[model samples]
Target: MPKLIVVAGLLLALTACGKESTPTPPPASQTTQAGSGPVDVNVPVEMRPVLSVDPPAQTPAPAAPDVLTGKDGSTYRVGPSIGDFGRFENVGVEQVDGRWVLNIELPDDTAAIFATWTAENVGKQLAIVVDGELVSAPEIASAITGGALQIAGSFTQKEIRELERAITGK
Candidate 1:
């Protein structure tokens, strides 16, 4: 009797596993509403990586302002690009007393040349350029005779680091 009972239970479980159900469709009115766009069907579909349909076009960025163009159409650039003007011996960011500044060091001969150049071009603006960008253009009030020059831009530590890298080419 117990064996017959177990066989009956097994037959019921096998019949339950064979049962199948059809998905119910939405009502016709909800699917075909007037003046509405096509219904957005939420179905699982295979995803794919997007690819460019057209050929890619590369565009160059605008050049930065480097040369100081004078009213007479004359242009001036620093270092070997121009005249025998002095090279920047050392460029770094340092804290003097309690303030941070970008320091530039020039040799004695170059310092003399810069002093003379500034003194001759007093009242004119000299553009301090970096990586073709005109960072600053201050009027030459007097000659910068001292070989050491400090640039204070009120920049933070990060900005100072970037500026140092830009100026030093490091």
Candidate 2:
């Protein structure tokens, strides 16, 4: 009947409208798998000392100084590359409490050096330098005698991998 034909047409139209469109492919740059290979990032990191006031250094200070500005119009400095990451033995990323953490392990001798440095610098902050940029300046609670340290940040999996690759260079 004509009524049956109209109902069929309506059903057909509804079904057509319910269909989902094909998804567009992601950009080529974003399709890369994390930790698959070297990621081209300019943010190379280095450990630097933190200072409340700029040191009495000569003009054109170190090629790069990690400067952190606080919301209260305060400025802090971290530099001289005290414990460069180049001496690290291994770096890995892990998830803890649904958050990403970067674990850095150093050799025995390097560990001792860090322990001594941290012990002496207790109650101070160590600037996490990344490509002349200060990412974070965490205070030293206790001496890091274990030679292994963990950096906890609310980073994504991709970011964690990128940081691991950046620091390890592997």
Candidate 3:
């Protein structure tokens, strides 16, 4: 089980670490039919270990080709490559304490599996990916046994609804 809810410094990661900084898909990729894409509720994939880069110049030329720099001169770590990926039984956009969140409910069997995985990987991050882009990566501090997960972020109604469609495929 994952730490049921991890709201700690997640926004900081978004603002400082990159990725979830923008709670919406790139304007270019925005669409009216988001149901076509799939959302992978990874612990950002399993809240796996990640290093946000503040690049150094004159680095070794032998660096991995995939290690590319962002427009802001920051490096984007290829995340989202390592955690668990699955479809939730339900996904909804709602307001909790004045903040909008993505509420996800997993299937019964998956809830048990997630509990085990989260227990083993405490302190790691859980990444949520939609269309292969890292949307949210919140750290897991405890195990999550229930199928319900609430991912908190700065979301507009449109972004949250779009995410809902993407995850539900409806």
Candidate 4:
């Protein structure tokens, strides 16, 4: 039996079958550009806790620079702390179900941390930061105990490789 899981915030759909879960792309409203952005591409990937989403704050806080304003004019805020499992052990793109998804492998210890964070923060969103930009903000639907995860969004082949290089530092 396949167990379906959702990640990537508003732009993720992944299906798990026999321990292999591949992601599916979201609708047109939300797409991810994990690499190409105006910000410097040298920054490492981080998962910061989302402070707010849509309907921008009445008076933006100090972390205004960290605000992520989408093309649709929706805005969101993320915590300053780099809250995440840890640096990924492996990051690469793969094709599944006719869509491209970013596959991330975490170390056992980091995976444990991720599991805990997810468990505690269910319903909260995480800012998937890649290359110093908010590439995705996926809500935590449930605890992800598995050592791996997939981020589904639109990315060109160049963007995918660029993201991998930035994340892997290779």
Candidate No. with top lDDT: 4
Report the Cα lDDT for residue 157, model 1. Answer: 57
lDDT of model 1 at residue 35? 20
lDDT for residue 3 in candidate 1, whole number 0-100: 7
* Weakest lDDT window of 10 consecutive positions for candidate 1: 1-10
Best by TM-score: 4
Tens-digit lDDT track for model 2 on 37-131? 22233444576767754434434334434555432233556557775554555565656556565566676766777778777885566665665
Model 2 bad stretches (over 4 Å): 1-45, 53-75
Of candidate 3, the 10-residue stretch with the lowest lDDT total is: 25-34
lDDT, candidate 3, 42-149, per-residue tens: 432233334444564555323452343433444445443443546556565666555555666666766777667666766555544444444444555556667666
**Could you give candidate 4's per-residue lDDT for residues 80-121 as a string of tens digits?**
754443355556566555555566767677777777887788
Sorted by lDDT, highest first, which candidate order results?
4, 2, 3, 1
Backbone clash tally (model 2): 0
Question: Which should have the higher TM-score, number 1 or number 2?
Answer: 2
Give a tens-digit lDDT track for model 1, residues 23-82: 122111212112211112122111111111112225332332333332223333422221
How well does model 1 score by local distance difference test? 0.37
Model 2 Cα shift for residue 113 (angstroms) = 1.4
TM-score of each: 0.45, 0.55, 0.52, 0.59
lDDT of each: 0.37, 0.49, 0.47, 0.55
